[model samples]
Target: MVDAAITPPSDVDTLAAGGEHCSAHEATGHHGYAGDAQALQNRLRRIEGQVRGIQRLIDEDTYCIDVLTQVSAVKSALDRVAMLLLEDHLSHCVVGAAEAAATSGDATEVNEKVREAAVAIERLVKS
Candidate 1:
């Protein structure tokens, strides 16, 4: 279904207006989440544990509602992680684009950055 198709990209790199790499930070192997990388990793690990627990619940023939409840919890957890990532992207990547545009006198990069963020946000809302 639609929800099943909604998955986060492994890498959020995209080309700019002129076919140039737009994500300067990602180009250099530095992500917006670099500072909170460890914390994010820890959260993802915990989510993985939760997912395994859900599998165990199903294996044990747990009530359907109980399984669904756990599933909702996991979804909520993922949403939190996504939000953190979005915040990092806006603060670092989008702002960097704006700064670069200030000197280059071309808003192409900034516009593309904003469009990317909007698309990401729309996907999140749909999910």
Candidate 2:
């Protein structure tokens, strides 16, 4: 996924000013959205609907147990989404970064990607 348009590091730093980029992937195109984009969108839509339903139930003063059940379902659905995203990230971005590091002495990029993923996992666990 190397980008021919990629500038030198300093040039990139200047060019990318005001853009959201913390990882080398932004320039290298090494990390990207992977696998079944439509499916991911569908899953997210379902989860979004589920959340709205929960809000409706709360508004209508649904029974405590029923609300709790919906809450549990939402949590499970969200967990599944997280796992799916994690799988894609591991199989694609993380692996790509590591391979690039091994072949091209870009271990810093791999380390950065891993650290980013670790932080995401930590946030998910906290949630």
Clashes of 2: 0
The best candidate by lDDT is 1
RMSD of 1: 9.1
Best by TM-score: 1
lDDT of 1 by residue, 42-124 (tens): 99999999999999999999999999999999999999999998898788887777777676766666766667677678779
Q: In model 1, how large is the Cα lDDT of residue 119? A: 69
What digit string (tens of lDDT, one per residue) describes model 2 on residues 1-127? Answer: 3321222232222332222333335545543444467788898899899999999999999999999999999899989888887777666666676677666765666655555566667668879
* Model 1, CA-based lDDT: 0.77
Candidate 2 local accuracy as lDDT?
0.66
CA lDDT of every candidate:
0.77, 0.66
Total backbone collisions, model 1: 0
Q: Once superposed on the true structure, which residue ranges of model 1 sit more than 4 Å away at CA?
A: 1-29
